[model samples]
Every structure is written in C-alpha cells, then in structure tokens.
Target: MSSSFEFTSENQDRFSQILSRYPYKRAAMLPTLHLAHQQNGYISPEVEQYVAGLLEVSLVDVREILTFYTLFFQRPMGRHHIRLCKSISCWIRKADRIEEYLVERLGVASGEITKNGNFSWEAVPDCLGACELAPMMQLDKDYHGPLTPDKVDQILEVVSDSDSKV
Candidate 1:
C-alpha cells in the first residue's frame, strides 16, 4: 500500500472483528463507513476506495453507504456543524421559524457553507433524540436547545472562538 493509503494492521484487524460481528460483511456496512468517517474528519473518495478494497467490495458499495448516511459528509465541512432540527415536536415550537431567523440573522441558509469556513448550516428534518428541547440545533457536536436567534448568536460566538484553538 502507498504510504498515504495504508490501512494499518491494527485497523484492518479491528475492521475484520467488526465484520465478524455480522453474519454477512455487507451487513457491516454502516460500522465500516462510520470507521472511515471517524478516522478522517469527513468521508473522502480515498477512504471509500480503501474500505472497498479491504472488504473486497466494489467502490460503488462503499460510496452508497457514505451517501446514504446524513451524518457522513460527502464533501469536506467546516469545523462546526449547525444542525437545526425541523422534526414534528420542534416544528410545533418554531423550529422552522428559528431556521428562518438564523438564515436572516446569521446570513447563511441550510446546507450552505459560510464565507469564513467556520460554520455549515443544515436543516435536520427529524428528531435529534431531544424533542423536549425543541427548536434546537447542534453546534460542534454540542446540543443547544429551545433556541432563539439570540441563543444561536451566542453559539456562533462560542464555536468561532473555539475554532481558533483547533
């Protein structure tokens, strides 16, 4: 394997163990994809190709898994992810309105990257396991809920400040 492309013996072993968990290797697709994404900040074609080769599967097989998962970033993303939930409970509490407020207030719409590369906004149309914390969004993997435009501004400040350290 090329220097940049090598999957270490340990990683390969772990992957093998993960595959063994399932009766079929194909059933282990999500775990395999999650491993690829965890190693890298986001899913890249190179990772997909490597995993495909390791599993003796086609590249399309790998690509399909990456594309199917919303958490998997098909392209590189900013340091922080702003996922505004639009699920039913959140919607009743103004999740969509908060989304609108953020777009108007923060000047970035869902699925768009900011000019500063510090943020990426997306509208998540499902429960984030915290319907009680409706009108919420996750920033930098941290959940902030029952939101208002002001709270989003606070989160943006915090995320931007933290990004400089990384």
Candidate 2:
C-alpha cells in the first residue's frame, strides 16, 4: 500500500540514531513507531506498513504492538488529547465526577472530540503512576491533578483560549 506519510529528513536522522542503539532492527520497533507517531500524529495503516518495512518485520507485528499500547493512538486525535486516569487510586478520588464534568463542559462523550476540534478525551484504565495526584488527567504532555470541577473548568478555559489564538 502507498503511504502518504514519510519522515522528514530530520526525523529520518533520528530514526537512524535510534536504530544504532539496538542490536537488531526489530529491537528498535517501539521507538521507531513513536517517531512515526510523533511525525504523523497517529498510527495509520500506512504507518504500520512503513515501519514494518523499515524494521523488516511483518505488518501483523506492528499492528499487535499498536493494539497493546494505549499510548499509540490508532486514529486521528484533536490537537489536545486528554487521558484521565481511571485506576483504583484515581477512582477512589472521584475521577468519575471529573469525567462527567468534562463530558458536560466539552459537550462530547469520552473518546469523542469536541465539534471545534480542539480536544478529545478518554478515560484510561491504568495508573498514570501519579498516585499522589489521584484524580489526575493528562492534557497533551502535562499532567494536572487532584482535579475538581472548578480546576477542570480553568484548564479548559486556558486550552480553549490558546487554541483560539492558534
């Protein structure tokens, strides 16, 4: 299959550097896929094929890796993706209420993007490793936590404003 995606020359250089750290090309699969995801924003079918060819692995191998990792987004996401930790620590802290607030405030369900395309959110099943920050959620790269409805509102305001400026 023809892929619309190709790494920029800089990323190709980074990919080569990553490969050098592994004894076998297949050992570099995760980082290579991360680079592709960073470049393409999600793991497309074409990206799976491209990486498989690059790593000399089968397409099924790549697909399996993608499925196993929640961090690898398989479809397009809004510019800001929110991952709310729903692990035991978070759940006890009333993360469900935070999730409800997000759905209501954003006017979209979990796993769905808002109509303006600025945000998408999902409740993840695993610990985000921040038990101290229970009821936490990740917005793009940053983690915000001990969340209350008011805190969530402030975050959305900041993000929405920045998105509008963009």
Candidate 3:
C-alpha cells in the first residue's frame, strides 16, 4: 500500500474541529473517514493508515469500520453512485424491473461503472427507510421512487447533461 497520504491543510483543520467534538480521538473515526473520502473519493489502504495515525487508533480498527459501512467505497466511484434498494419493501414493489432498466440503459452491470465514468450502480440489501416510496433508488444523496423506465431515462438525461457542463 502507498504510504504517501496526507490530509490537506483545510482538511487537517476540519479534522481537528471534528476531533474536538468527541471526548476521544477514536470516536471521531467516522467523520475523519468522510473527510478522507471527500479528498480522495475512496478509502484506500493509504487512507486507512492516514486515518489510523490521525485518530491514534489501530489500522485494523479503522479497516473494520471502513469495511462495515456500505457508504464507504473502497474503490473509486463514478460521478454518480446509484444505489437501488433491494430490501423486502422494494422487492415486492418490483424493484427488479428498475434494476434491469438501469442495467440496459447504462450498458453496465450492477456494481460496475459506465464506459464514460458517468454512473455506477448497485443493488443494496439494506432498507433505504423510504418504504412508502417503494422501488426507490438513491442517486448520490437524493431519492427517487416508484420508478418507471421513463423516469429513469429522465433522471439519466438530467445527470448526463449536468455532468457535461462541469
């Protein structure tokens, strides 16, 4: 693993502020990991070492937390990370169709990035806590639900256009 990780000055200050909120440095692990992810887009082995050093915790402790959280990506993600809920609520609502449509439309299998690096998708086993809006998928931080192929196309078009501008 690479050992050249170093948080930026601003992130270091942010880390200090986050650490101050907790009684122990180890308690600040989650937010510290978030800062690292924001900097590097994914938690690599180097990031685990960097975070372990910052929190004065064992690398194993940091790795355990990283592996346990679905939100933390060990590998790089595309501009959009799409998570389709595969829990009971969503499954009964025919979330499978939504997944299939996305796979066909994006030309990538689940948990794979698109050719243009615009999108990555996965079916998550956890409930997204929006059962009322079943068959829901989260694109980045926002939830869209009761999804139809038409809606999926619209969402992809908007995201694609937005990405082009950037």
Candidate 4:
C-alpha cells in the first residue's frame, strides 16, 4: 500500500491561517481538529497526543473535541465511508439484505474499514430523510438509495477507479 499518507504542505499553511483567526490558540481548536482529520484519514490516539501538545491543551480537551463531533472519526476508516440506513421505513423495504450484501462483498465488519482500505461501511438507523429512496445509504457527502446490491456494487466501481485516492 502507498505511504502517501500525510497532510500536504499547503494544508500546513491553511492551518496557520486558521489558527490566526482566534485570540487564543485554544479558540482555533475546532479547525485544528479538522486539519488533523484531513491529514490522517481517521484520528488516531497518536494524533490526539500530537495535536494536544501542538495546541498546548490537555489530552482530555482534545479527546472531548473528538467525542463531541459526529464527523470526526476516532477509529481507522477506509477511504470511502458508506452509511446505510436501517430506519423503520427503510428496513421494511429490505435494508437488511442490502447490508448483508455490502458486508459479504467487502469482507468487513460493521463500523470498521475494509482491508483494502477501499471502503468503510457504517450501518446506521435512519431518519434517512428520503422515504422516497427508502433503501438508501449516504456515501461520503452524497445520498444514494432505492438500492439493490447491484447498484451498490456499481458505485463501488467509482470508488475503485484508478484516479481515486484516499
């Protein structure tokens, strides 16, 4: 696997700019946390320590930042995140089968990333907000639903596309 795993030099400049936005460095905590996640795919314990030191905060403070945000991930995750909705409405439409398909195909457990790092799937209950697209999953920032495993497989094609990167 490639070791091209680090925040770019430009991101460092952006971090500096972000930190400058506040009176105290602690005030920049939010964006700094984001920068750390952007650099590493997921927030590791090592990152927690490093950023706490960099920001001169207690590890508890940094841990709080991670726990409070739904977006920041503490565990390792694949390049792409797939969140399947298992709400009452969606489940009635056979969302269970869809989850099984994804799990079997990717060979990964719930709430964990795949071995290839091509995908990480999270099966969550929804108020999916798209009853019209009942059997749905939110892929990254996009919503995909009214699904069959075939369609999900097709989407994986794009995730594995040569041009894609983690």
Indicate whether candidate 1 or candidate 4 has the larger lDDT.
4
Can you write out model 3's per-residue Cα lDDT over 1-166, one digit (the tens) per residue? Answer: 4478889999989988998899999999999999999899889889999899888899999989988988999998887999999999999999999989999999999889998888999999999999988999999889998888899999889988898898
Off by over 4 Å in 2: 161-166
**Cα shift from native, residue 11, model 1 (Å):** 7.4
**How many pairs of residues collide in each model?**
0, 0, 0, 0
**Higher-lDDT candidate among 2 and 3?**
2
Clashing pairs in 2: none
Error (Å) of candidate 1 at residue 78 is 1.7
Q: Candidate 1 on 38-84: residue-level lDDT in tens?
A: 66757777777777776778888887776677888877776677888
TM-score of each prediction: 0.76, 0.91, 0.93, 0.80
Question: What is the per-residue lDDT of model 4 for residues 1-166, given as tens digits with 9 covering 90 to 100?
Answer: 2223344789878878997888888888888888888788778878777677767898899988888876788887887888899998889999999999998989987898887787898888756688788899888778887999999988888768744654
Of candidate 1, the 10-residue stretch with the lowest lDDT total is 1-10
Q: Which pairs of residues have clashing backbones in candidate 4?
A: none
Of the candidates numbered 1 and 2, which has the greater lDDT value? 2
43-145 per-residue lDDT for model 2 (tens digits): 9988898999899999999988998988899999888899999999999999999989999988998899889888999999999998898999999889998
Among all candidates shown, the one with the greatest TM-score = 3
Could you tell me how far off, in angstroms, the CA of residue 97 lies in candidate 4 after the best superposition? 1.8
* Cα displacement (Å) at residue 79, model 3: 1.7
Cα deviation at 17, candidate 1, in Å, is 8.9
Candidate 4, residue 148: how far the Cα is off, in Å? 1.8
What is the lDDT, from 0 to 100, of the residue 86 in candidate 4? Answer: 93
